[model samples]
Target: MPLALYLLALAVFAMGTSEFMLAGLVPEIAAGLDVSVGSAGLLTSAFAAGMILGAPVMAAFARPWPARSMLLGCLMIFTMCHVIAALTPSFAVLFATRLVAAMANAGFLAVALRTATRLVAPDRKGRALAILLSGTTIAIVAGVPAGSLLGTALGWRATFWAVAVLCLPAAVGIATGIRPAGRTSLGEPDHEPSLRAELAQLRTPHVLIAMLLGALVNGGTFAAFTYLAPVVTATAGLDPVWVPVALMLFGTGSFAGIVVAGRLSDAHPRLVLGIASPVLFAGWLILALCAARPVLLLSLIIVQGVLAFAVGGTLIARVLYAASAAPTMGGSYATAALNLGAAAGPAIGALALAGHDELAPVWVAAVLTGTATLMVLPSLRLIAPRAHRVAPTG
Candidate 1:
């Protein structure tokens, strides 16, 4: 609820816009750089790969620094990379800049999660995280579409320039709004865990399960979502113009879901995941079965959106709570694990597409989410005790 949390959300909005805006601009980028669209699509993969590799390493190195400083530095680097990306003439240069920008994005998010949780009461950590991550949902709803329009009107380069300009205010907000005392209160100098100790926490059973859960949950949703366009148009027989409308509806559902999940997670994270996982499985299953009904499919899309994001706040809360002693590293692992799932989901969907029809992704998502449900059942025993002990003390 602090101003600092909103500022962090602003930073996330800038990064999320940059991450997703590329999807809409891929064709323009391909044409501008004289490359194939398939090649240009690799730019998205590059950013995800950078986040997967950069997050834990950045967290380790940044373990000793003030969270505010790390966040500000990452924002500066991210902004500069976007500026270079806007100006780059070569595809290779643009790709490299995207990688750097994603690395900065990952670093900023990991630190932001830790900082946001620290800013609030222990019981409110889930809500704070949800508010921070809502920036991404907002980006999907508004920023990506606006960037696409901007690219059409001005140029893809202009969109990048606009994103760079957007970061300036977020960076200034962090520098001014977050105090040194707040940063120190999160993790005192004497209590800072060593890199080895933090890394060792990954070997804990509950922590590892939390990471796996994060990956599978994201993988399931994205497996279907990554190919939503063709499924909605060709399979569902919807007008192509309705694709953006469907996406906007999904984003709206996601925003609402995260807020509700955040509140539920404050009291019972396990129960939240228990309900969410089944909802996700059923949503995808129904979507697959009713793919030919345009109205039904659209309704299911919104349901899927809510179910997909409903688990997000709880997942992060579970990881941070289970690994409370190594929260920075745990947060980084959560980010990296989720990105790995993001990468894997599309690959799984692509394979399903190669062997089956467009509706295959929906079924694939159902199976993945169903598996996530089963995974959570066993982990509940491990997480419940920790949840009880972590009641808000401050």
Candidate 2:
């Protein structure tokens, strides 16, 4: 809601773009570097792995610095990584640059989420988070397509250069719009989180369940989403040019879902997951069954995007609420689970595709979503014991 929030979101947009833009640029990068596409795909995997490992490390070690400073530092690191990526000639150097870029992204997201949650009214925390995170969805909408086009027109190197250019405006905006430490009551003084104590909080069954559910759902979603372009083109018979348009539709649905999910989180975080998980499962099922119809398949993808994304904010907020003892550590683990899911999804989907055709991946995704729904049931029940009493009845 505040100007600072949008500035933070803008930074997130740039970071998110840089992180995933590699997926579109992989073929071009592989060709330029005289490597196979499979090898170039490693660039994307390396980024996710970096996020998986670097997020907690950054959160734990950088706990003493002010939030704004951390964010600025992250942006600088990201900008430098992009610059190196653009200028580097050797494939090894380019790969290393991507890894560094991934680390910067992980740090930025960890701090950005923390800052966004703290910046809003207690009752509006969900909406605030959704606003900030929509930047990632916005990247899927705008960044991937633009990156792909840029890669096609100029070169993959030019796309990296474009990201570096975008970071300049993002830095300036963050500096201008963000409140300095001690300026806003919401931006409290830094309190170093105890990693040991935070790890101890995992002994709580609810927390464990939340982590499991987060990983499962995220892995399932990414498993399907990572390969969406091929699935739509090969199975649904859509034009290749339409893949980005379909992805844009997914992003639109997700962005809308995020706004509504924020309101539902404040009302009933636990129940919202129950409602959303089923819809996500159904969406996958429909996609699997109607694989021959481009229109029907795209419709299902839209629904999947909306319902799946709607639960994200609610689930993360629920994890934080459940882990009242040490939110920072809890927050870090939640993000770690998310990254783990991101890593797992594609692997599982690739396995599913090994012995079958394009439509086979949809079945795998459906199974994963269904399993995730089942895994989440106990935790959802634990949180909303009264069925309807998901939030404090104030």
Identify the leading candidate in terms of TM-score.
1
Q: Candidate 1 at 318: error in angstroms?
A: 0.8
Candidate 2, superposed: residue stretches over 4 Å from native: 183-193, 383-394
Task: Report the CA-based lDDT of candidate 2 relative to the real structure.
Answer: 0.77
lDDT for each residue of candidate 1 in 29-108, tens digit (9 for 90 to 100) = 99999999999999999999988888887888787788888999999999999999999899999999989998989988
lDDT of 2 by residue, 58-158 (tens): 87766677777888898999999999889887888888887888877888877777777677764566677778878888887898789888989999999
Model 2, C-alpha of 83: deviation from truth (Å): 0.6
Which lDDT value does model 1 have at 259? 84
| Reference-based lDDT, residue 319, model 1 | 74
